[model samples]
Target: MPEAHIARTGPRILVFSTNPISDPGIDLVGSAHMRYQPGVVTIPVPCSSGIRPSWLLHAIEAGFDGVFIAADGGDCAFVPDCTTRTAKIVDTAQKLLTEHGHDPQRIKMAAICSVCAEPFVNHMEKFSAALEALEV
Candidate 1:
């Protein structure tokens, strides 16, 4: 997949990752170079499941188009019947945003592994698409 490009005037995105995200996640280095543009930032988090609602809200209020959360869920997978906390938190946050008239799609989460580059990139693409669909 090609790197996702955001026009200079477009709303930016803050990607909060719950696991390691490598450079190869993007299709090319040239595209990767554009990452620091006004519209994109990648932040590493301990776990996507544990991200707080307050943090998400802060980003939204700061003019970010959206927040994309990706987590290495192998831990959760190994612990069956343990509905992970991060998943629940993200869902709760989405609901809260909707109640306030904001498009809940602004907050998104995906279960992914660092080594599985394609799925991770796909999630980012989907998140970007959703943000694009928002009417601001």
Candidate 2:
């Protein structure tokens, strides 16, 4: 088979999606033919609250222009307080970015539901625009 080609002409975003919640929504964005930036990528985790702050920093250090946490919010099956925990994670990650001389705005978080394809695509577009504006 011919090698697949992906155009990387935009801000790169690394997304952490909760497996039981946001992941399905992100997947639906593709399966439903919703359009988003080509540089957007995703990794599914068991819970958004479980994401390590270091991972967010690593994504930036590894060349991703921004990191987006697709939080499970109140829909998390694994943790009742997942939204609160994830918010703390985002806060810590933003502080870490700031301490490293990176803009705290490079990271964003939002709740995405199981069938929220349009919202996911919208978030990606807006996040990509915001990252481009940062121009770092």
Candidate 3:
């Protein structure tokens, strides 16, 4: 089988978003005509708390420059402790990144609400900048 190809012109970021919450906010960025880095890609999951640390590491190994977790925070309807659980996932992923000689800063997490189009764009911009700086 041929290897999958992703042509990236700049820092490539993979974002994990909660389907019920942050996914809508990320979608709003496009609907509202807000622009972010072309390399930013998002995959919606049922809940942020369900994300596996191994998946985050796999993204880095698969050529992503960074990974961002758009956590549901206090607004999660699926898990009452979603924020805390997601934070632990970040911590574990960072530790694994460090163990494998990768920069732990490549992972970031933040709360993005359903109506946070502008904020989502802002986060993407900031994350892109941060990833670029890491390469320097």
Candidate 4:
């Protein structure tokens, strides 16, 4: 029996959180990414929107597969426009990546509310699968 091989393509996913990982009540997400730690590296940012263009470019230059910005939505306790701007940059960056002949799928954006962890995990899986398809 031949097992299908999965090529690990795409920049290793970096999940940028607008809130600190140390914050309480962040968990409620059991099966959400708790099963296996794949290529995802989580970095807690002040605000997902605060990520600069240079930083994103630096990440790509550093050999990252891709960067995924997931910001706080619904009730934005910190800044109202933070996640909005993050979404904007994500769109802008994807276009830039496509312009450079790179797979624009390298960048992604998602808004996570209190109960959206499961969906978040789902997106991660889908993104990873899409990356795999791109390799084919």
Index of the highest-lDDT prediction: 3
lDDT of 1 by residue, 1-53 (tens): 55766447554778766544332343232354433234667777655555787
How do the predictions measure up, each by TM-score? Answer: 0.69, 0.93, 0.93, 0.73
Cα displacement (Å) at residue 75, model 2: 0.5
CA deviation > 4 Å runs, candidate 3: 1-7
Clash total of candidate 4: 5
For model 4, how does the per-residue alpha-carbon lDDT over 1-136 read when each residue is reduced to its tens digit? 4575676644377776666421111243553445323677777766666777556656666777777777765456666786677777877777777767778777777776556666667777887777667767
Alpha-carbon runs more than 4 Å astray in model 4? 1-11, 20-33
lDDT of 2 by residue, 26-124 (tens): 989889987887788899999999999999999999999999999998898888998999999999999999999899999999999989889999899
For candidate 2, give the lDDT.
0.92
| Cα-based lDDT at residue 36, candidate 3 | 88
Q: What TM-score quantifies how close candidate 4 is to the native fold?
A: 0.73
Residue-level lDDT of model 3, residues 34-119, one tens digit each, is 88888889999989999999999999999999999999999999889989999999999999999998999999999999988998
Task: Score residue 10 of candidate 1 by CA lDDT.
Answer: 51
Global lDDT of each candidate = 0.63, 0.92, 0.93, 0.65
> Which regions of candidate 2 deviate over 4 angstroms?
1-7
TM-score (C-alpha) between model 1 and the true structure: 0.69
